[model samples]
Target: MALLSDGHFHSGETIAQQVGLSRTAVAGHISQLSDWGLDVFKVKGKGYRLERGFSLLNAESIKKHLGNTKRAMIDVESVLPSTNTEMKKRIANARHELADGDAIFAEIQTAGRGRHGRTWLAPIGGSLTFSMYWSFPDGYQSMAGLSLMVGLAVCEALKDFGVDDAELKWPNDIYLQGKKLAGILIEVEGQIGATAHSVIGIGLNVCVPDSQYDVGQPHSDLTSYLGHTPDRNSLAAAIIKSLWTLLPKFTQQGFGPFAPHWEALDLYADKRIVLQMGEKRFSGIDRGVDASGALLVETQDGITRFHGGEVSLRGNR
Candidate 1:
C-alpha cells in the first residue's frame, strides 16, 4: 500500500519483489485494500495504481511535525474497527501500562462510530481518524466543557492551516459553511474526585470523494473549503499539539477561559435552533455555551441550559 500510495502504477512482479511476496500474494493484498474503500486500478501492463494519492499516517512524520514535544507517544495502524474502541481497550485492559497523551491513528475504520449511535464511515485515506488517551487527575468531575475545548482546538488547528472560517457547533462538532466537516466523540472512565482516563476520538473529512460523502447530512470537506488541507500526518500533528496544550491548561483553569472562545466560534449562536431529547423537542435561540460548556438557549419560557447527549439537532434545525 505504501509503495502504491503515489498513485503511480507498480507492477505485480515489482511489488512482489519489493515486499518479498509472491505475485499471487500481492494480488490478494491489493484486493483487500480495494475492499477497504481505496480505489485501485489494475491494468495489464501498468499493474496497480491508486485513483488518488495520499500519505498514510506515519508516526515519525507526525512526531517531527510535533516539534520536540515529548508529551505524546503515537502509533499508526493500517486499519481498525474504531480508534476510540482501541484506546478504551488500552485503558481497560492495561491501565497501568499506558501514559497520558497515548494516541492511535487508523487509516480506515470499518465500524467507526459517532454520537447518537451513528456509524462514522469514511473511505481509506479520505479522512483524519484517530483517538488520544488523556488523563485528568481531577477526575471525571474536571472534564466539564472538555469536548467544547477539543472542538476549539481543532478549529484553531485548521485556522493555522489557513482555514479561518471553521466554526464550532456546540457540544462536539466543527462546522464549515454551516455543514459538518468534523465530529468528536469523547469517552471517559473514573470515579468522582479521582483521576480520570479518557479517549478523545476525532474524525475530520479531509478530501472525501463526493461519492462517499453522502451520509444524509449537509457535509463538506476541508479540501473543498480550503482548496486543500494539510497531509494526514501534518494535520494530525497540528490537532494533537493543540489538544495537548489545552489538556493541562484546562485542568488548572477549568472551562471558564475557553467559554469566550467557544462563544466567538459558535456556529448556531443567535440562530433559531431546535433540540430533541427522544420524542420531546424544544425550540429556542442558541445563546452559545456557558462556562461549564452546557449550551445556553433562550426558550419561550426563559433562558435554559442543556448539556451534551440531549441536543442532537441536525434533523431538527
Candidate 2:
C-alpha cells in the first residue's frame, strides 16, 4: 500500500517481491483495497495504481504543526469503528491519561455516525474524521452554544487553508455553495450540577472518491475548490490549533463573542428555509441566531427561537 500511495503504478512481481508475498496473494490484497473506497486502476501489463493517489496520515507531522502551545494528547489510528465512540471509552477507563484537550483521529471509520442517527461514510485517506474531548468547568446549563462555537472555529480554520467561501448551516453543518462540506456531532456526558465533558466529532471531506452508497445530500470536497488535495495531517493540525485558541475564549465569554462571526458565515441568513423537528415542520426566513445561538426564525405568525436538539434546518429545495 505504501508503494502504491505515491500515485505511481507498480508491477505485480515487484510488489510481491517487496512484500514477500505470492503474486496471487498480492492480487487478492489489491482487490480488497477497492472495497475500502480506494480507486485502484489495473492495466493488462502496467500493474496497479490509485486513481487519485493517497497521503497516509503522519502523527509526527501533525504534532510538529501543532507546536508547543497546543497541549493535547493526539492519537492516530488506521481504522476505527468511530472516533467519538473510541474517545468515550478512553475517557471512561483511561481518564488519568486523558485531559480536556485530548483528541483521536482515524483514517477510516467502519461505523461513523452523524446527527439524528445518520450514518457518516468516510472513505479511507479521503476525509478528515476525528474527535476531541473537552471538559468545561461550568455545568451543562452554561454550555448552550458550544457547538456553534466549534463551527466557528472550523470555519476559521478553513479560511486559513484558503477555503474562504465555506458557510455555516444552522446547528452543526458546514456548507460550500449549498453543498455539504463538513459536519459536526457533539456528545456530552455529565451530571446536571457538575462539570460537563464534551466529545466533539468532526468530519470534513477532503478528497473523497465517488461512492455507490447514497449520502442523501449534495456534497463537495476540498479538492473541488483548492485545485489539489491538502495534506490531512496539516489540516488536522490547523483545526486543532484553532480549537485550542477558541475554546479558552468560549470558556470565559460563552457564545456571545462568537455570535457575530457565526452569523456572518451563516448560509441561511435572511433566506427562506424549513426547520424540521421530528414529524412537524416550520417555514420561515432566517434572521440569524440570537446571542444564545438558538436559531431565530420569522414565520407567518411571529418570530421564534428554536434550540438544536432534534432540529434540522434546510434551505428551500
Best by TM-score: 1
Cα-based lDDT for every prediction: 0.86, 0.87
lDDT string for model 1 (1-317, tens) is 89988889999999999999999999999999988878899899889999988878899999999998765679998888999998888888854477777889998798899997789977787799999888888788788999999999999888778898888887898988888999999999777777999899999999875566587787888888877746888999999988888888998988989999899998887888888887888888888878899988898789999988756754243
Tens digit of lDDT per residue, candidate 2, span 1-317?
Answer: 67888899899999999999999999999987787777899987999988766888877889998889766788899888899999888867854567777889998788899998899989777799999998877878777888898988998889878998989998999988778989999998778888888899999999753354347888888877788999888999999989999988888888988899999999988999998898999999999888788999999889999998889888877
Clashes of each: 0, 0
Q: lDDT (0-100) at residue 201 of candidate 1?
A: 93
Pairs that collide in candidate 1 are none
TM per model?
A: 0.94, 0.91
